[model samples]
Every structure is written in C-alpha cells, then in structure tokens.
Target: MTRAKIAKTLLTLPLLSAQLLACQPADGQNPAQPGQPGSLKTLSAPSAAELQSLRSSELPEANTRFALAFFGDLLNETPRENVFISPLSLSIALSMLYQGASGETRQEIADALRYSGLSEAEINAGNLTLRKRLQNSGKGVTVQIANALWGKAGLSFNAGFLSRNQAFYDARLEALDFGSATAVARINQWASDNTNGLIPKVIEEIDPMTILILMNAIYFKGDWSEPFEASQTQERSFYKADGTTLEHPMMQRYDKFRYTNNTDAGFEAVSLPYGEAEETEMILLLPHAGKDLASLRDQLTPENWQSWLSSLRSRDGSVTLPKFKLKTERQLNDTLRRLGMVKAFSEAEAEFDSLLDNSPLKAYVSEVKQDAFIDVNEKGTEAAAVTTITVGATSIQLPQEPFEMVLDRPFLYAIYDRATESLLFMGALNSPEL
Candidate 1:
C-alpha cells in the first residue's frame, strides 16, 4: 500500500492522448475554445479582494525576483532592439523539469529559479494555486495556460514525478514515438492549438538523444479597460534606443491612470487595467530624461519593482503608445548558465535520476528554448508564449506631457495578474515593429 507501489501499479496508465497524437479535440477540453486539451479541473475566477489576498500571500518574492533577473538577462541579450518573454511560461516548464532532478542537480535548479529557502512542496502548491486562480483573474480577459508531457513511446518514468506534476500542474501525459516523421508536426500542432495559434512551432527537430519533451503554453487576450480610439492613432516620432527616430502609429488617449513619476529611481510608470474587475493589468515603465533603457534594465530588481508599483497613484494625463506586433525566440541555455543553473544541462554532471525508471541511455537536459509573440493595439493586447524545455529546458501607463506621458522612446511593459501579483509577461521595445 506504499505510495511508490501505487505509482508503480499505475505506471502503464492509459496515455492521456492517442499514441500517435492524432489532432482532434483535446481531452477534458476547457469550454473556452478548440484546444482545451485535458485541463482536468475548472477554476472559478476569484473576486478582486480575493485576488489581492492571493497576490499578497501566494506570490512570494522569489518568483518576482527571478522574473526581474530573467528580464534583465534578456535585455542584455539584445540591449537595443525589441525583446519579449513570458517568465511564467518559462518557470512552469523549468519547474516541470525540476520535478525530475535530484541531489546537486535539484539544488542548482532551485537556486536558479530563486527557490532557495522554499521546499519543493511549497513551490508546487504555490504554483498550483496561482495558476488556478489567475486563469480567471480578469473579468473579460482570456488567459489560458496548458502543460503537457510527451514521453518516448513505452518509457516508464518515476511515478512520483509524473503524479506530482499532474496533481500540482494539471499536466497531461501522452506517449509519443520520437522517431515518427510526424512528431514535429504533432508537437507544433499542440503548441498552436494551446496558444490560440500565436505560436505555431516550437521545435525545428527532435534531437536523437531526446527521450522526453515538456511544454508549457500560455495564451492571453485582453481588451484595455479603457481602450484607445482608433481615430486618434497617428504617426509620431518614436526615438529608438540607438538614438534614431522611427515614425510609428502611436495610439493616443486621455484618462486618469495609476501613475508614478519617480525622479530618483529614474523612471515613470502607468498602469492600465484589462477587464471590468481590473484584476489583470499592464504596466508601462519609461526612463525619464537622463536614464535610458539600459540603466532602467539595471534597476529591475525586486525591491525596486515593488517600490515602483507601490508608488503609483491616480493621476490625470494623456498617454501615447505605439501599435506594435513582435515575436521573439530564445535558447535559454546561456541564460540558465548565467543564472547559475549549471548542473542540469551537463550531460555527465547532470542527475535527473528521478526521471526515468530504467533507461540506459542516460538523461540530462539537452535544450531549453522559448517562442513568444505580442500584439498591442488599440483593442487591448493579444500575446502568447510556448516554453519548451527539450529536457532543456527552459506595461503601462500614461499621462500627458507634464501631466502627459508619451512613450515616444524605448520603454518597458508587463502583463500581470494583480490577484497573484505574478508577472505573466514582460518586454522591452526600442522601436515599434509591426
């Protein structure tokens, strides 16, 4: 009657999806759309007050700290161009990978993920609650998050690892023939379906050494609580980080927004709500006169971010932002290394011993990559990201000139759930790209 024995008994549990991954309606699909794919649980949207409590209680400083560090690293990758990422997606994928690690490998991943003082149980429970609650964070917004495990056909993994993720992450499992010619298409199709077609492909090819594939996809579409009128969108001079001007369509609107002008911190910010409840919001950060995006990026610490968000207040102003659409792709190996996740990626040093039941091929994370897309128009925002850990793993505001804020230069933006206070996405746009 032991837990291990129970898992062992369930080792050959029916595959959650067809062995061939035939594309059809997903299992236990959410009522929202075509790609609900085995959600297993339906979570009700929390009230604004409940969301505030969740943000305060569930969202500890660790994930937020990691999010900021992750963003800073991405900015370093491409200092003066456009870059966007979903920290939530990346964390979920890596966390799923983290479930299989042991010894030094586990320790390193915990450190890299900023889970230093927390137990794995704590992290799992927190992720579960946050993910469940945030799905309905915005009253009129659509936020879908999906996770799946694609194992090499007939592979038997540690039952504990699989069950833990299934319990905490609602991740579905499917057996897949890695050697199948259509393997790539099947995965890409799942990614497309889950992300509402925002990201149609995640992997170009399956490495011969690959045995397992874990994916996390997030799709978000929200209309601004107060949308910018299309009639007011006009060409404006937007200065790039390189000091060149790019004339792009800037959507203009006047409204009272949660605004902050912190001269000492070298940035000004504004918060724009998404749905009627306003539990989900986008925050915009612009470095004022003397500060640039680089300096602003450097200041992206958890402490500074908290200070910035706390300092916001209602202010009357006219806000101008560009109508932009951009896509991003990144290989996270280097970034993970920089963030101190050295052991997991090593073919020899890595110890994902808890992953497979009895495979002699040896398992170590081989790749970690992510693809994300974002479109910010007058209607609101449509964004999606797929973080595929090939064992690899892994906003705002406004206000007028003086009382008017014009994001005619490089700036930062974020989409977040106020209830969980968890950052869903973040980006730096030097110049508007459509």
Candidate 2:
C-alpha cells in the first residue's frame, strides 16, 4: 500500500488571483495585472506587530503550504490577474455557505474561513442575511449542496467525506447509488455548467460501488495586457529526482522579481508577481544540492518562513520555468491531524452544532477526501479541487520548474494568503502519484 503522506508545514501564499481561480464564477474573475490601473498590496508590507496580532491560535500554522505531488507540476510561472475583495464581503459569502452546513462539522469551516478584520456589528448583520438566504434559498442547485452537507436525505448530491471511498451526507434519506452513470452524468453536468464550460466534466462513471477517483481542475483565462509571445518560449532541462532530466518548454522574462535565500536549507526562494507589483505572487522554493527535500522541509517553522521572507531581495534576473501540466489527488484526513487540527477529526471535540439547529448532534467528520486536477497548455491553467466531509466517512495539482528548482525527491509546498500570513492550504508529496 502507498504510505500516507501529508504536506510539510512550509505553506505558500495564494494571493487574489489564485483564490479567484479556486472560488470565483467564470465571468466574475477579475485579474490583477502589473502596470494596470489598480493599487496592490501584500503581507510583506505589514509591520511585525501587526502580523503577530493577526495570528490565530485556533488554526494550524502548518496548514499554510502548497502540496503538489512528486512528478506533478505546480504551474508557478503563469502571469496572474488582480482583483479587490473586501474582506467583509468574502467573509459574508463563506459564512452564508456554512450556515446551511449540518452535523458537527460546519464550525471548523466557519472558523477556518473567519475574519479578524470585520467588526461585531458587521459580522452580526452578515450572519443574519446569510441565515435567511440558506433558509429561503429556492430549491436550486445550491440547495442540493446544502442538503448534502447538512445530511439532508433524498438529494441527488453527496459529500465524499475525507475518505478515499464513496460516502455522502444524505439528510433527506435518499437511496442513491454513487456508482450509477446517471449520478456521474449529473455531477459532470453540474461542473460544466458551474465553470461555464471551463470544466466540462468531473465524474466519468458512477456504477462502481468502490471506485477510487482523483480530480483537480482550474480555469484561468485572462489577457496579460502584455502577453508573452510564443517565440519567447525557451527550451530547458528540468532535473528529476532520479538524477535524469527532461527538456521542457520554459517561459522566460525579465521583470522585477522578489528573490530570497534560505541559508539553513541551502536553497533559494523566488516570487513572481502576475499583474500589479505585489498584489499576487507565485513563490518557488528551491533546495540546494545534496540536501534531502525532506530534511530542508523539517526546518520550515513559522519563524523560518518569516526569516526566509526577510532574506528576499528584489532583482531583475531573467527567469526561466518549465511549462507543464500536472494533476494530483490524495486522502488527507490523517494529514490534517498530523499538522495539528486534531480536534476537528475527533467526535469528543468536534463543535459544529452551531451550523445546525439540533441538540446533541451525534455527528463528526468520518472522513475527508480531496481531489485536485489542473492542466497547463498554451492557453493557460485550468484546475479544479473538491473537499468532501462525510459524517460517517472521509475523502480526497501544479507545475513548473523555474531557475532550476529540481524537486528530485519528496518536498514540501504550500499556497498561502500573502496579506494575512494565513496558510490557506498546505501539502507534502513524498511520492509523485499520477
């Protein structure tokens, strides 16, 4: 059996563009480009005290890194568009979704997506409106999602939980076969419609009672305002962990970049901003020669991450990165606990009753299943990810090498919130799974 692997604690920051890729509707994605007519900001601009004050003891600091599997490409060299999201508005939107969550699980989701930037009055007002929406939301597709999450039976939808198998919350008590082709077709159609054709289909079959499936899809289409010509693409060798290598199409450009070095790990980390100067940055951390990626990752404490950022020096070097398409899916329930979110998985400590209006809620996350699928071609990256929370069970990609950061063996990665120092998501890939 493949050993279970969780991502290292070294998280990556997912700025505005990355978040939009994960959450926004197709037509709503607003890219933030460099030299564009908008003001941009990042976590680096804040004071040390301010950074500290924003820290939360409730969430795991280790949850902040990016997790792209071995042999999997995490496309980091793409240019990103910028957008402004009012912290209050984003929080309200997420809260509304959480209110409909059932069982003893929604609290963790709310806490994870909470905001310190909002005032008490604002939070209260937002909660009221969100509650109303969940209660009054018509019998639309979204209601089906709420039903599945809250364990409402009879709905065609189901939450995969965090497990590797097929499990769902059916509060409506519907007898649904997850392996049915009809089931697969319904989900595929939903994905296609939701992504506005960006993701045509996610589920290909639904008749197998126990089928293991992995998925990740992202859709990003934006004009760079100043697009890179195909003629500018360069050929380069990306070092594989096996000591062999492959020549790949590498994107190259000379622009203002944020570069940093980690003395302990003997590697360099660089940041490439898409649109505005510092609005959203794609970070790449490369380990030095003869150093095990795992060993270097062991030293990735919050302090070290902060120190590494301090060492970053802006430069104008020519950057080269492989343009590759990669996708990854894994079981991550055990991983989240290893990273310090133990209470979330335990029935004794789970506190998600606030999400429902029931007493003595006898429910807990039975599993957590996640799948991430992303592709990078000439057009750009199209990726999608889903996390299933099963009360009785559980469930559930990226590319590119630039400046020769060869991830030969197992390594740590992350995608973070640059402004809040919050680790939005983190993963460790011990072995590359295709």
Candidate 3:
C-alpha cells in the first residue's frame, strides 16, 4: 500500500415532520429547547492533562474486533477490486453518531461496532487517543485526521448530541441550507483541504430530505527510513490475480525488516518502516503459491490477526516490491446491512430520537460512500482516505521467515501504527497498473 490516496462519502437522511416542537418563549426564562436554532451550547476543549491521559490509554479489544470484522466484510464484498479502506476513519465518524443514538438504534450500532461491552465514554476516549497519536509528526512522516458535522439550517437537533461530538471528536459544526450549491461546495472544499487535495470532492449532491452529514478525512505521507535508490527500480514481470502478467517498475532494497513466514497462516510477510519514529510500518503479506488470496483473507480473524503479529520476527531481507497506485470508490450500504445493521437504513424502524427534538420524525441512512487513493514508489508512500457516513453510513499484520520477500505477485498490504496497532490503510494489489 504505497503512494495511496483515498476518499469516501456518506449521506444520512433524517426525515422531519413539518410541525415544529413547542418551546419556551424566546425570553430568558427557561432553558432553550433541544435542537432549536441557537439553543445548542458548545463544549469546551479538553484540558491538556485530560488529553494526555486519553493518549496514554489503549484502544479496547472490542474496537479491534469491529475493525477486523468490518475489514473482512469489505474484502468479501469486493473480491476482485484493489480494495483500500480506513477503519479508523469510519469508526471515528460512527462513534460520533453513537453518542446521539438511543435504545434499539444504539444497541444495533453497538452490536455492529462491537461496542456492546464498552461505555460511550470509553469508546470516545479510545478514538481520541488514536486520532491524536496518528496526527503527531515524527521525522518525515505525516498523518492527519479531520472530522466535521454539517446540519440543515433551521433543523432542531439535540444539544447534547452536538456537544458530545464536539467534545470528543473535535468536530467543527456548521449550519447550512441543504438546497444551496454553496453549502455543498463548502463541504467538498473542506474534504479537499483536509485530504491535501487527493480527494477533491466527497459530496456530489445533497438530498433535500437529508438533514445532517458526518465526515472523517485521513492523510498520510512518509518517506521510507531506508529508501530504495531510484536507479535500482527496474521493469519486471508482475503477476496478476487473473492469470495475466504485465511489466511493472519494481523497487528493490536490501534492508533489515521485521519478517515472518507463517506455514499455518499460509503467507510470507515483511514490515517496512517509515521515518525515524518507526511507529508506523507497511506490512506486506504474500500468500504462498497455490494459496488463493481469498482463502487467506477468510482466515483473517481477530485471533488469527493477533497471532500473526505475535509471530513476526526481526530478520535481514532482500525485498522486491512493485511501484503501484490505486484509486477506488465504493458503496458500503449493502455491506453494512449484511453486518446486522438492518434497522438504521430503514425509514420506518430507524431510531434517532437522541439526535432530534421531535420524536415523531422518522429517518434512516440512505447511502454510505467512500473514495480512496494511494501511490507507492521508491521515495516512500502517500495515501489519503475520506469517509462520509450519511446517517446512512457505514464503513493487519505480518509474518516473517523471509530472508527474502519478493512481492512480484498479487499480495495484501497494510499501513499500521505500531503504537496503537491501528490499521490506517489496507489493500490487496492484484495488478500493477503503473
């Protein structure tokens, strides 16, 4: 997963009734009604000590389970494409939404996210810790995470919902007229800016009935700690999943990388570190010849993933990896529905009472979209991803024995944070287009 760029779009429609909720008079007599315009209060930013404490906490096992499960589902659904996704981005956005969910809606999301046993405070704290850690700079590496919320003007939302998201996710909130083109442009501009223009647009058009949009953007750029010389990059035959071979520019480097050969798991893996922090590394998993990528992916359970990580060992190795770039757009609505989140998409049964002041308003998720891009070459790797969960939203490791790891065939790769064990970006390179 070298030199990659990614983006995503999500749209949620909360259908509101024409009747407005009754509220106390505008006079300064009683507290303002929840969701009323100007009634919401912004929560103050967390103190330095609080943020430090959060940073010290590790992501819960439940969060890891949800991430691995979602990755498995995405791989199963898109069996052929060059797939790449940011589980952290999706989780952060969903975690924000979870704060506003109640009853069955909360339970369904909790179940789907594997947050069943964790408290909302714990979930939010974990997300904050990872988000802040990923963005901190070390040597030549740069990882950035951004979040935002856009709401339809005049819509009354629960003040607590707004406050919680702001407090935890550091989301910037804006009120917009959904019918206006300017509003759409502004939102897209934010996406572009956050992703360093790798993703110029995440929203094509805003549905009239749509009342809110939640978004997350992630950007990563890093130079290899021991970069390959450009002169060593040579054209070589690269095998494709479809039994075809094409000439691709292959980068060759002889370096000491954490490597492993897992006979039980059926793949050879190598870890390529970036920058001085060595906190993030790209783990490449090349399945043994005769073993299909699909079958190997099927065995990628949480337990297996952990076992593979634990089995990785340090070894000096010769590496040959192709220079490749991929850009993809995927709709995750169907995949999410298959993952036991059936009620949220239903206009009839979806529950979002915590998000709005009016209990009678019925709303559901209409779409979940993502766009991503990546480019891996001799200098290093660059990747970007944007995830937009529109109410309707939806959204690892290693091996070694490899004294020599040549990724000339189809293989899987993951850009992971060593500190948090977070899979920032992942994909399978079936063919080398560049």
The candidate scoring highest on lDDT is 1
Q: Over the stretch 320-344, how does candidate 2's per-residue lDDT look in tens digits?
A: 4444443433434564344333555
TM-score per candidate, chains pooled: 0.86, 0.52, 0.85
**Model 3 lDDT per residue over 245-274, tens place:** 778788898877877778887787778899
- Using TM-score, give the best candidate's number: 1
For candidate 1, write residues 352-396 as lDDT tens digits: 767765444445666677788888899999888877665521145
Candidates ranked, most accurate by lDDT first: 1, 3, 2
How much lDDT does each candidate structure score?
0.71, 0.34, 0.68
Off by over 4 Å in 2: 1-151, 154-184, 195-229, 340-361, 376-382, 393-417, 420-434
For model 3, the local distance difference test gives 0.68
Give Cα distance to truth, residue 316, candidate 2, Å. Answer: 2.1
